[model samples]
Target chain A: MAEIAIILLNMASYVLVLVLVALGLVVVFGMMRVINMAHGELFMLGAYTVVWLQAAGAPFWLAVAAAPVVVGAVGLVIEAALIRHIYRRPLDTILATWGLSIALKQAVVLIWGPASHSVAAPMAAAIGVGDVTYPVYRLLLMAVAVAIIAAVFWIFLRTDFGLVARAVIARPDTAAALGIDTRRIYRASFVIGTALAGLAGALVAPLISVDPQMGLGYLIPAFISIMVGGAGPLAGVLVGGGLVGGTNNLATVWLSPVVAQIVVFLLAIVIIRLRPQGLLGGRDGA
Target chain B: MAPRWLAGVVFMALAAFPLLAADYWTGQLTRYLIFGLFAMSLSLVWGRAGILCFGQAMFFGIGGYVMAACTMGLVGGALTSSYLGLAAAVLAAAGFAALLGYFLFLGRGLSGAYLAIVTLAIAYILEQTLKSAYTLGADNGLSGVPPIDLGLFGASVELWQETPRYYLVLAIVAAVYAALDRLLASPFGVVLTAMHGDPRRLAFFGYHVLSLRLIVFVIGAAVAGLAGALFVAVDEFASPTLIGFGLSTEVLIWVALGGKEMLLAAFLGAIAVRLMESTFAELLGDFWILALGLVFMVSVVLLPRGLIATPLGRLTSGRHRDGT
Candidate 1:
């Protein structure tokens, strides 16, 4: 019973990470219909920023706080320079973003020299949970992810930006007629999405190895999460992330890590076949 | 007439490339040809049929493994080299395509984006499966398999080396390209073009949307398998990377860069990217990925129809407009 409880706790934290990663994908792919393949790389950038800042002797909390802003600015520049033109064509964006991912990966390799960064666990957050001995920082990480998800949901539901963004998604020309700056919304949303990915990376950097190709590792599952949840739906991302995360964690416990990963993918396929739009995905976007 | 001669000359040059180029370049070209074939298969489904299959590598890897397994004949040695191995690889790929397509083509007609997501999942799942032991070789992949002997000749052509394998790949590429061109020029190709323009209208005109998708999907898979077989034959190695999403997307980029509508475009794009990669490796070292990204962004926005397609359209239409 104790082992089961510990497993469940670990699974919950993993789901939290999935939710953080999936949130940006939902906003970018769901509303924009633009599958930003570089989204994972942006996450890597965030993690790298934290790592670099920490290396420079900055406090861990300050590094975590500053990472997203730095990453988001980079994302804004990418959108301004390249992503802006491809808005009219979604497939083009996918390909372009994919290229961006490759480029970003290479850039990371150049900057960091291809080795995984040793991001020390925050000393303030370490804790004991009987036999398991959980890290307090991890718990804090979960809280942050939850807070961000809530904040995103609130913004989407209650904010003017969300309403205008939805209007653009529904019909960009119509939104233009209604005096909404569709282009600005697109830029802002993309930046935010990238930032969310970065934030996930910053929080999870301690747990996972921060390497150049680390983005590619996350890219597949994050995509699976997006598809299983329904591309753009927040609730769908939640359910999808939970399903993939929970199952993956449990499966790893029972089977080898390789088998566990395979099973997770298999489960995702089954879910997609059953509900193509994802569990919470509506019929709005393709 | 001059253009036709130029094309012929180019083909001949490519045919005799092993003799002309260094051993390393010959081997590189051989790799490019396999990837080119992979890209061409994607073009059939994505460009011509408008079915954006992000997991084409799934078939490529599947065919490779089937070829490897059969060649080794660990479980079923009798099936190897009995003309059945090649058939089995192609059939297995086609079968897998049909099964996956059945599920994907459910509810509403799948858009390119949705298809990409679904296919991405498929590719990921397959890669993971191959990474696990007992079933696939897991990470390291199955190796030490002997060359495939096609019966009439008792001696197996060792494709592990460079020169002979280059000739073999070029021949297969030519055959594949010719078959693809013929298929595209047929009535079936016309229907696919129509389907791409308007699927609802095509369905109303009595065309079975699902069936057409399945046909193209299966055909594409079969071709991918052929590429896989050739890949294993040449490299004498297989890795889960064959079925990776990155590889599939890379193939898609090649199709986009070359010319989706033109079969030759796939080969051209593959060659261009490979050459650029080698250049980047030599010069830029670590910054090549950045250059590739910039290239992809520029190519998509400026040449939406691809380099060959846009230029060919311009040249052909330019002459006609001037004449009129």
Candidate 2:
């Protein structure tokens, strides 16, 4: 029972990480219909922001707080400079964002070199969970994930911003005709999505190796989760993250981590095969 | 279409290049020729069929593995022949594409971004799988795969020298270009153009849309596999990067920057980008990526037809325009 409980906790943590990484992507891809290949680069930029701030004598928590702002600003700049121009051409957007991804990665490599950096977890202590003890930092990560999800849900579903954003997504011309600035909505949504990805990166920095290429690892799983979950933000993240993350964690218990990844990919393929619109049955951008 | 006379002239220039260039340059050109072949494969599917495959390296990597396995005698000692290795590489890549396409295109079908994302995922999966597969040398990759050994009857002629190897590669590339050009001008090619233009309309005309897509995908994979096999032969090494996202995106850039609509233009784009990398990557260092990113952005936004293809299209009186 103790082992099972620990496994469940571990699975939850994995699901949270997947959800956090995917939340930003879900917003940008689902709402704007822009396949931002550089989405991972935004995450990488957030991790770098945390690292750079920490190196400059800020506390870990403070650095984490600054990450979303720094990365969000960068995201806005990218949206204005590049993403704004190619919104109509989806395929061209893929190439443009891919170029952005490569450029961001290379810039990081240029600035910090190719070596990996490690960030210390602020809460190093362990907390008792029934019979087993878990790291406080891991527990904090889960709490953060839940808080962010709830926050996003509230903002998108309950707030005026979310209502306008959804309207723009559903019918841009109609939204524009109704006096909503669709362009502003696109820019805002893109920033919010990138900021979420940034926060996720900052939160997870202590647990994984931080490097330019590390974003690719998170990006792939996040993509799998989003695809499996479909385009709907809240339900998609929950179902997709739960399924991909839970299955991967379970596979890790029974098989190798590599095998677990393969299992998740196989599961994604099957999910895509069965539910072409994704498991949650949302409409595709096409 | 480029003037036939211009193509002949260009071929003549390439055929005479070995005579004037240094042996080292000739060797480098050999490698570039293989990349050109890879770019042509991408052009065939992406330009002609409108299927933007972002994970072309998967097929290339499959071919490399098959070539390595066969030449190393890891897969049936009798299959150690270079000819058999090349054949196996093409077949393995095509087979993988057929299976993958069947799953991807059979039902409601995936197009645009969904297809790109799935293909990219599959390529990443293949890279991870190869990295973990100990029999294939894991991350270190397989090395020392023998070069092309053309055995006529009992006697074998190994292409070990620089000039001979260059000539051999050139001959194969020319043959492939000629054959592909002919194939593109056939009735099947017209169907491919129509399919890309309007799949629903083609389906209405009783054409099996899925089968056309699968066939083109398989053909493209086969060409990429052939290129990969040749690459391993020239380099005498095969690594996980051969089948990963990095090379896949690089090839995509090559085809896109060269103008995917024209096979020759795409082929030249690969060579030009590669040559530019060798020169500028050393001088500019990491800033080279920034330049490349700028170029890619500009190409996508301003010159959707490609840098080379735009002028070529105008020069050829828009003959190369495929209604895209």
Candidate 3:
């Protein structure tokens, strides 16, 4: 029973990580219909921001705070320069962003040698939950992930910007006729999604190996989650993340991580086969 | 595609290349020719048929493994024939493609981005599986596969020398290219092109869209597998890299930058990238990749017609056909 509780805690934290990483991917790929292949690199850049800032003696919390701003700015530049022009061509977007990812990764390799950097957790206290004593930072990570998801949900549900963004996503022509400036909405959503990815990277920096190639390890899994969860609805993030992440983590505990990954991919394929449009999708984005 | 006369000239140049070039460069060119063949296969599936097969390297790798196994006598004790190996390699990849395509293109049928994502996942799975299969050398890959051995009635000629190997590869690749070019110009190509433009419209005209899609996919896989098989012989080894995300994406870049729509342009794209890589890889190293990335992005955004294709179009303007 204690082992079960401990396993559940570990799975929760892992699911949170998957959700955090996938937030940006879902927003961009799911909502915008833009295949931003460089998203993982953006996440890498986010982790690097904290790494560099902490290296400069900034507090870990401050570094985390700066991640969104810095990453958002970078995302802005990417949009203005590359993503803005090719919104209609899905295949081109993939190639262009793949190129962007390659460039971004190489830029990091040039800036920092391709070595993994470790960040110390901001807190080390242990809190007892049921029979398991979990690390406080991990518990805090879960809380923070939930808060971010809630904030995103609230934004999409309640805000004027979210309402307009949905309008643009659903019917850009009608939104433009209503003077909605769909272009600006696109730019904003792209930046938000990218910033979210960066924040997720910063959050995971202390737990995972922070390297130029760190984003790649998460890239496919994030993609899997987005695919399994469905990309049309925002809530798909939770559903897909829970399924992919929970299964992976649970299987990791029982089997090997590699096998767990394969299992998740197989699951994703089966699910996709069953529902080509995704579990929660509408209007045939799939 | 290259104009007939221009293609003749290019073939003449290729045939004459080994005389002026070093043996080392000849061997390198052989590999590039195989890559060029691989790029053309992608052009047919992606450019002509509008299928973005992201995990193309999976078929390529499958071919390499089968070829290596057959040629090395790993599969059967007495079946070390290169001819049999190549045939088996092509069949294996095509068979895999048929099975995968039946699921992916049939029923609810994934298209565009969804298809790309699914293919990418499957490729990742195949690569991971290869890495974990300890019997297949567990990521280090199978090595020491012999070169192509040509058997006649009384004697056999081993492609031990660079010149012979290069010529053999050139002949096979040239044959495949010509066949594929003809195919694109046929009524079959017209239907595939129509389907790419609007599958719904084509379906209304009595075309079996699913079968066409599967057939083209299988053809592409067969070509890629042939390239992979030939690669094992030329490289003298088969590794996990051939069947994974890296090569898959690399090939995508080649086809896209070359112009996914043009067969000859795509072929040249792979060769040009290889040439530049060999040159700049030594001087600038990683920065070269950065520059390549920037160029690819700019080309994709601004020159959607393609970077290499844009210029090549001008070169073969009057000579080119709609089939090309």
Candidate 4:
């Protein structure tokens, strides 16, 4: 019973991290139609920021708060420069982002070597729950991921900016003709997308070792989630993340992690074939 | 006048390459040949068929592993020699490609994004599968592959060192290039080009657009497999790198750098990028990816048509060309 509870807790943590990762992709790829292959690397950068801050003798709480801001700022710069130029062509966006991913990964390696960096979780949050001792940092990560998703949901559902953003996605040319500043919305959305990815990375850093290649493992599943959950819908993102994360975790527990990955990807392929639009997606959503 | 002589000259240059170059140069050139064949196969889908495949490595790797198994598998009465191994590898690659391509291409439905994602998934799955199936050597991969042997004439050509492998690679590359060039210049090639432009338009003209794409996609995978077979013969090993996403994307960069439309150009691109990597990576080290990124950005911005296409455009326009 205890082992099962621990496994379930671990699975919940996996699903939580995946949801955060997929949420960012859903925002960027769903709205902008860019695949953002480098999104994983952005997550890596966020994790590294936490690693760097922790190394510099900063308080863990302070580092956690600051890491997202720093990473989000980098996301803003990426949007302002290269991504802005290639908004109309989504495939080109994918290629460009892929290039960015490679460059950023190499940059991370150059700065922090190829080895994985171990980060200790916050001293206060290192608590036990019942017989199953769950890392408080992981629970914190779950909280943060859930909070961000809720915030995004709130912003999209209630805010004027999200309305305009949805309007642009619905009919870009019409929105442009109506003088909605589509480019600004694109830039803003991209920054938000990148920031979300960074936040997920920072939260995940203490739980996993921070390495240059860390982001890549999460990339395929995040993509699968967005595609399976439907592109932009919040519910789809959660469902997609949960399905992939839960299945992958359970599969890994039963089989090997390698076999689990293969199975998940195979499932994604099948899902894609059956529902070209995605499982939870409405008509017109990618 | 220049086109015919250019083709002939290129062929002649390739023909004379084995004799002039030393053993080391021959092997390096052979690797180039194999990569060229692989790149050209990608061109069939990416260039002619307008499918931006981010996962050519899947088919390329699969073909490589199949060849590895054929040569490495010491089952009863099975062929262990490189020649038969290479042949078996090629057939196996093509067969798997036919199956994979049919399913993937069917689901693709002319959506480039969907195709890219699907291919990526296949590559991801296969990569993980390769890691798990340790009998094929997994992460360490299969090594100690013997050189190919000809028939029972007791006069077999083997790649003992760089020279034999180099020349062998050169011969295969030249032959593959010739075949590809001919195929691309055929009426079928023209239809493929048209399909790339507008699939729906071609479908209206009674073309089995999906079928045609599938055919080329399979052919491309087969050619990639052939390259993989040759790769093992030349290098004497097969690692997961041959089928990795990095390698796949690198091939795309090669095609884009050289000009995807032309068969020869893609090979040139491969040589250029690899040569750059060999020369500059020591000095640049980790920043090498930055250079690639810069090159891609510049190419995307300035030479979107590719080096070959840009030069051809200049030549056909009868305009004075700027230094590329």
Candidate 5:
């Protein structure tokens, strides 16, 4: 019973982390139709922002708190300077953002000197859930992911800004005709989406060795989660995240990490072939 | 769209290149030529067919591994012939593409970002698989692939010298380029262009859009596979990077910066970027990537047609005589 409980908790935390990582990509891609290939780099920037702040004598939580703000500001600058020009051309945006990813990666390498840095988890305690004691940080991570997702749904379903954002996503021309500032909505949505990615990155920093390429490792899985979940409804985030992240966690336990990744990707391809709109379809909202 | 003489001139310059350059440069140019061939394959599918295949190197890498396996006698000893290896490489890569494309192009199929993301995922999968498959040398990859044995019957004439190998690669590239050009000029090409511009319109005219796309994708994969096979002759090693995300994106940059719309530009673009890398890598160190990335973004945004393509088109094509 303890073994099963432990496995279940691991799977839940892993899936929630997948959800957190994929949420930004889903919102931006679903709402703006922009690929944002540099998204992984945005996540990397978030973790590095924490690294940078802590080195300057900031507390761990304070650095984590500042990650989203710094990353959001950076996203604003990128959206204004680069992304603003190519919203209509998805293909060009893919190439452009991939270019941005390369630039961001190199910039990180230059700043951090290509070495991997490990951020200490603020919590030194563990909570016993049976025979196996789970790290406090891991439990906290699950709670944070759930809370953030709930907040996103609230923003989408209840807030006035969300109503306008959804209007733009549903029909940009109509939204503009209705006197909504669609441009502001796009910019804001992009910023929020990137901020989420940063937050996810900062959260994961304690668990993984923080490196420039670490973002890529998480990036593909996040993409797989989003793909499995479907790109539309908010519910797909959890569904897709569970399927993908659950597969990875369970497979890693049974086989190897590499096999786990291979299986998840192959599963996603089959899913995409069978249902391109995803399992839940593009219904949008909660 | 460019003048036939410009093509002739380019081919002439290629033939004269080995003579003018040093042996080291000659060897370097050979791989660049293979990359150019690879880029042209991308141009055929991406620029013309409107398929942005982000994982093209997977096909190329498959070809490289196939050639390595065949030549290394991993596949029965009698099958170690270079000719057989090249054929196997092309067939293997094309087969994989056809299999992948069938699923990808099924129904309305995945286009734009979805297709790109899926293909990238495949590359990621393949790279990880290769890294773990110990029989294929795991992360170390297979090495010591012999040079192409240009033998007919029992007689063996190994292409070990730089000059001969260079000529052989160039000749093959020229033949492939000519064939692709003719294919593009055919009636099939017209349908392809129509489909690229508007698949629904072409479908309205009763063209089997799915089959046409599959054919183009298969053709592109086959060409990339052939280039990968040729790459073994130059590098004598087959690593997973040949089929991974880095090489895949690098090739995209080559085609994009070279001008995806024009095949000649893509061919030159790979060679140009590689040459720039060799020259600037020492001076710029890791920062060269940042510069390249910046230039690539600027080019994609400001000059959608391509950096090299725009100027080359103006010089060679009468259509752009007015500089529009």
Candidate 6:
């Protein structure tokens, strides 16, 4: 019974990580209709920012806080320089972002060298729960992920900026005609997505080995989750993350991690085959 | 579209290349010729059929594995013939593509980025699977695959020298290019163009869009498989990286930079970019990636027609329509 509880906890934490990794992609791809292939690289940049800041004698908390800001600023520049030009062309956006992803990855390698780095977990204590003890940091990460998701939902559903952003997403031409400054909305939404990805990366940096290629490991799963979830905002990501992450975790118990990944990927392919709009997506899922 | 005489001229130049270059350069050009064949396969599906396959190396890798298995007598003793190996490689790749295409294009169909992403995922999965499959040599890959042995009813000849191997690969590439050119100029090709221009309209006209897509996908896979088979013979080895994401994207960069709309341009693109890499990689170190990225971005954004294709298209009276 205790083993079951521990497994469930582990699964929940894994699911939360998956959700966090995919959150920014959901916005950029789902909301903006822009396939940001460099989304993973953005996450990497954020983690690197935290590492660099903490390495420079800054407090760990301060480094974590500054990660999103640094990544967001970088995203803003990318949006202005490259993404803006290819917004109308989805295929071109994929290619362009792919190029950006490669450049960013190589740039990271150039700056930091090829060696992997590890960050100390800020809260390095475990709490007893019945027969099993769990890391406090893992639980804290779960809470942070939940909070971030809620914040995003509230912003998109309740805030004025969210409203305008959705308006632009739904009908860019009409929104532009209505004097909504659609371009600014695009820029802001892109930045928000980038910042969220950065935050997720910062939060999880201590959990995994940090390196230039770390982002790529997360990229495939995040893409699968978002794709399975459909391109919708909150509901899509939630359902997609739950299904993919849940299945992946459960499968890990029965199968090897590699086999589990293959199963999850095959499952995703099956889902997309059956429901082209995704599980929770409407007609405009594309 | 590129003037029929140009093909002959290029083939003649390639045929005479060994006479001008040393043995080392000849061997290097053999590998480039194989890559050029791979690029042509991509151009067929991406350029002519309007399906931008992001994971083309998957087919190429599949072909290489099949060829390696057959020639090394890993599959069965009867399949050890190089001729049989090449045939099986093409068949295996096309079969895989056909199966994948059935799932992908049978329903509402995955198009554009969705299709690209799914293909990329599949390629990644295959690469990972191969990496762990110890029977297939895992990360070390399969080595010592014998060179091409043409034995027709007991008369056999092995292409062991660089010049012979280079000429053999060149002839194969030229044949594939010619066949593709003929196919692209046919009535079937006209329908393919129409399908790309507007699939829904073509479907409304009673064309089986899914079947057409599958056919083209299989053909492209077959060609890619042939390239992979030839490549194994040239390199005498096959690794998981041959079928992975990095090589897949590298091919994409080559094709895009050369010009996807024209087979010749894309083929040249692979050769040219590879030549440049050989020259610049030593000088620039890791910065070559940055340069590649910048070139990719610039080509996609500013010159969608590609560096060679854009100028060449204008010169050739713009016969081929621009495609992404």
Cα-based lDDT for every prediction? 0.80, 0.88, 0.89, 0.78, 0.89, 0.88
Predicted candidate 2 versus true structure: per-residue lDDT over A95-160, tens digit per residue: 988988888998999899899999999988998867889899999889988998889988899999
Per-model TM-score on C-alpha atoms = 0.93, 0.97, 0.97, 0.94, 0.97, 0.97
- In model 4, the Cα lDDT at residue B133 comes to 66
Deviation in Å, model 3, residue B178 alpha carbon: 0.3
DockQ of each: 0.66, 0.68, 0.86, 0.54, 0.64, 0.75
Q: Runs in model 4 with CA error above 4 Å? A: A124-129, B1-4, B14-22, B73-78, B107-110, B152-155, B316-324
Clashing pairs for predicted structure model 6, backbone only = none
Better of 1 and 2 by DockQ: 2
- Report the lDDT tens digits of candidate 5 across residue range B246-285: 9999999999999897888899999999999999999999
Instruction: Write down the worst ten-residue block by lDDT for model 5 chain B.
Output: B315-324
Q: When superposed on Cα atoms, how far off is each prediction in RMSD?
A: 3.0, 1.8, 1.9, 2.6, 1.9, 1.6
Between the candidate structures 1 and 4, which one is better when assessed by DockQ? Answer: 1
TM-score of chain A of each: 0.95, 0.97, 0.97, 0.95, 0.96, 0.97
Candidate 2 C-alpha lDDT tens digits along B245-295: 899999999999998988888988998898898889999988898789878
DockQ of 2: 0.68
Report the CAPRI category for model 4. Answer: medium
lDDT string for model 3 (B100-153, tens) is 999999975988888888898898899999999987887899999999999855
Show the lowest summed lDDT stretch of 10 residues, model 1 chain A.
A124-133
Highest DockQ scorer? 3
Ordered by DockQ, highest first, the candidates read 3, 6, 2, 1, 5, 4
Distance from true position, residue B275, model 4, in Å? 1.2
lDDT of 3 by residue, A147-246 (tens): 9989988887799999998888788899999999888988999999999989999998999899988888888888878888888888888888899899
